[model samples]
Target: MADRNTPNRPRQRIIERGIELLLALCGSISLLTTLGILGVLVWDSVAFFQDVSILDFLTDTQWTPLFADKHFGILPLLSGTFLTTLIALLVALPLGLLIACYLSEYVRPAVRNVLKPLLELLAAIPTIVYGYFALTFVTPLLQHLIPGLAGFNALSPGLVMGFMLLPLVSSLSEDAMQAVPSGLREGAAALGATRMQTAWRVIIPAAFSGVMVSVILAISRAIGETMIVAVAAGQQPRLTLNPLVPVETITTYIVQVSQGDVAQGSLEYNTIFAVGLSLFLLAFGLNTVGYFLNRRYREHYD
Candidate 1:
């Protein structure tokens, strides 16, 4: 209460205010950036919809915007996006859950420290490198087994994207499992539950909310991935579920149109923004689901 008598008290208050202002600005940056992106997408999408009806955009089966006979139906792109994401989930989920269980329950702390980082390094590899690896290596390996697999198909990229997302799922799930109280484990042991049974029945159910959130976020990430799909998943936008055939996703379409060949103000140019908005909405929905799941079912322990 007598700090006003201190010579440096006023200076300390000013410094504290300055630090608070700086931290607020840093936190606001993400919010501002997200608003900026949404604004741009809505602005450009308005123009695109002026020329192309919303009904056609939703109902059109083909997406041949660059061709002489132009079409803007987004179904093909959506199908392709769905197919690749499905493949990636199928590949990542079980393997990631197994890896998480092993790391959280079985591995020694020292070994987990070493192994987790090594596993996470897969995520650090540039996505373009994964793209090229899928195109050059995985595709070739698959061709030897599948009789009529296209040179550029969804399977290879989907598989590579799965590997890339493995670390994210496993890491998040392992952290959630680790957060469960040690007393739970001890109680299970006292009840004569085997280690495997305890981990499966007790720990997993307790951490289910976190694990579910991680899976949702991973699905969003797989949907939004770009380069690997761009390189290995072909540019042909076809409404097909055959992973052996070439197809293009919403993200692949955005990359294709953003390559500077399309004029900046043309309908083709505006299509990118429209599709960008769709992708944004998809991701936002997935994130919303994850957030709600985290909030609603999250366990509280003192």
Candidate 2:
């Protein structure tokens, strides 16, 4: 037994060291991949800025890069993206929280088992499918309510995008609420607070970080969403604040240009990187703001 154990010990040590090395290698690969993407975007964006002045790119009112004479304004795309994202958040935020509150405070565990999966199934649906559904079903439904609604407008896509994000917000918010110490809920109840009052005052405040995380993630997802907005919101990048207008988002423009419509190595092609970098910055800024806001209201519920 001693002889066998001695041989096995050295072999096991070698295996353990090999596994550690493999994991380190895997982590390095992931970091390298991220750096590679950043490098490409920065390199191309620098080259693009050389041709299109940063001022023109930032302040240009028109974005007709594919035309004979180009206008490289980013306002149109940014506005569209913001419009759709804000609209989606307006729709999703309240509904998702209410759903989370109900699921956390009201529903039985058995019912949650049945309903949560069903809700999550929405997240599994392909974006293209949601886009088609928005185009065909949601748009028609909205036209009946709003006069002069465009055939392809921001509203339909925004509404569908909200629905697509609902599950994410609900799941995250519920998990956060669940993580709140049971003692807090019990203390509120012991003080004669009703179930609703306990969930509202006790659990929600304690789970503020989680709810904010869900909102930030939902906003990020909404901002990055492509096919649904592309299909439901028309491919025209108009600088209008109106949600009823047909506008093109940053992601839609990227997709449109990537379809071999623009020449390679041209200023237009370079704009894709610039636009993507801008988007990365936008999402980063949003997360940063949310972080500060969370910190402001965050409490130590103990």
Candidate 3:
């Protein structure tokens, strides 16, 4: 019996080691792939900057990368990206927070179980489908409501992106609200505080950090989004703050350049990398802030 047990133990150890080795190999492969992409982006962007001055790339108001007389100022694209993302966040945050409050504090348990999954299903839809919906459905609706709105302006696309990001913000916020202790709500009720008052004044303040992180994450998604902006927003890069006009974004520009016939070694080809680097930096900054806020102010209900 002892000899049999010894043999089985070795076999089990071999299987466990095999699983560990496989997991490590897979992790290393994923990390290397990510690093390779970043390295390539940096390499191409460096080539672009070597040919063009950093000041011109950053401050120039025009983006005429495809023109015979090219000016590679990236500010317009950056501004457009920010404008749309800001609009998206403005629409998403309030609606999402309200939905979260309803889900966490007001809804019956049976209703919540069904509604939560349905709401989360929004996140599972393809972004390209959302893009098409923006172009066809949302743009026309805006044209009816807001006269003088262009066919491919920032408002429709931004609004659609807001809808797309709503589920993310709502679900995360709901989780945070639910994390608030039941005792607090009971104590507030005992003091004659209404449910609405407790939710708005007491619970929301406690969950503000988590909700802020969720909002930041939604902003990052809006910024990185490609298909909706590309399909709905026009490809004209301009320095304009008006949401009613057609504006190009960094993601849209990247898509445009990638689909063109530019040579791999030319400035136009390398410009894609430059824009991508800017986007990467923007996302990284937002994520860093979100991470620190979550760590510093996350509530411990227990």
Candidate 4:
């Protein structure tokens, strides 16, 4: 018995060590990948900044770096990105919250189990399909109602992107609401609060941090979205707030420059890296803010 147990212990220890090493490698892969991306962005962006001043890049309103007459102002792309993100959030937040409240507070477990998966299936649809759907279906339909809306405009794509992001917001929000203790609901009922009142006043507030984290994540997703904006929203980089007109986003510009026409190692080619770096910064900022907010407001239940 002693000989058998001693041999098994060494074999088990070897297997455990192998598993530990594999897990450590898996964890480091993501961090290493992130560092690699940051290094590339910084390296290329340095070359791009040599010819184009950072001041001009920030202050200039034009973005025609592809043309013979060059401009590198990022405001147009920034505006378009923010515009679409705002429109998407407007469409997603209210509807998502309503759906979440319904799922979390009103529905039975059986109904919620069935409905949540159906709702989340929307996220599985390819983004390219959504882009084409916006162009072929939603844009023409909107043109009939909105007299002057362009064929390739921000409104159509923004709306489609909003719907694309709906599942994310609703699913995360529902999870947050579900995390609230059942005792809270019972107490609210005891105090004569109706379902709507309890959800609006208690559950939502309790889950605010989680909901906000979901929203921030959705915003980052909206900003980083490429296909729908590229296919539906035209490539015209104009710094305007009107949703009826065509505009270009940072991701679209990266896609445009990456299409093989632009020479590698050239200023135009390097612009993508610079734009990508800016996008990285923006996303990082939002995620950092979300992290702090979550830490600040997160509730710990016994």
Best by TM-score: 4
Query: What's the TM-score of each model vs. the native?
Result: 0.95, 0.93, 0.91, 0.96
Candidate 4: clashing pairs of residues: none
Residue-wise C-alpha lDDT for candidate 1, range 187-246, written one tens digit per residue:
999999999999999998889888998899899999999999999999999999899999
By lDDT, is 1 or 3 better? 1
Per-prediction backbone clash count: 0, 0, 0, 0
Tens digits of per-residue lDDT, candidate 3, 33-115, equal 86887898899999999999999998999999999989999989988898889889888999999999999899998999999
For model 1, how big is the CA root-mean-square deviation?
A: 1.8
Model 4, CA-based lDDT: 0.94
Which residue pairs clash in candidate 3? none
**What TM-score quantifies how close candidate 1 is to the native fold?**
0.95
Ranking by TM-score: 4, 1, 2, 3
Q: After superposing candidate 3 on the true structure, give the runs of residues whose Cα lies further than 4 Å from its correct spot.
A: 1-4, 7-14, 26-30, 299-302
lDDT to native, each model: 0.94, 0.92, 0.91, 0.94
Model 1 misplaced regions, further than 4 Å: 1-4, 299-302
Write the residue-wise lDDT of candidate 2 on 52-76 in tens digits: 8999899998999988988999999
**Candidate 4 positional error at 191, Å:** 0.4
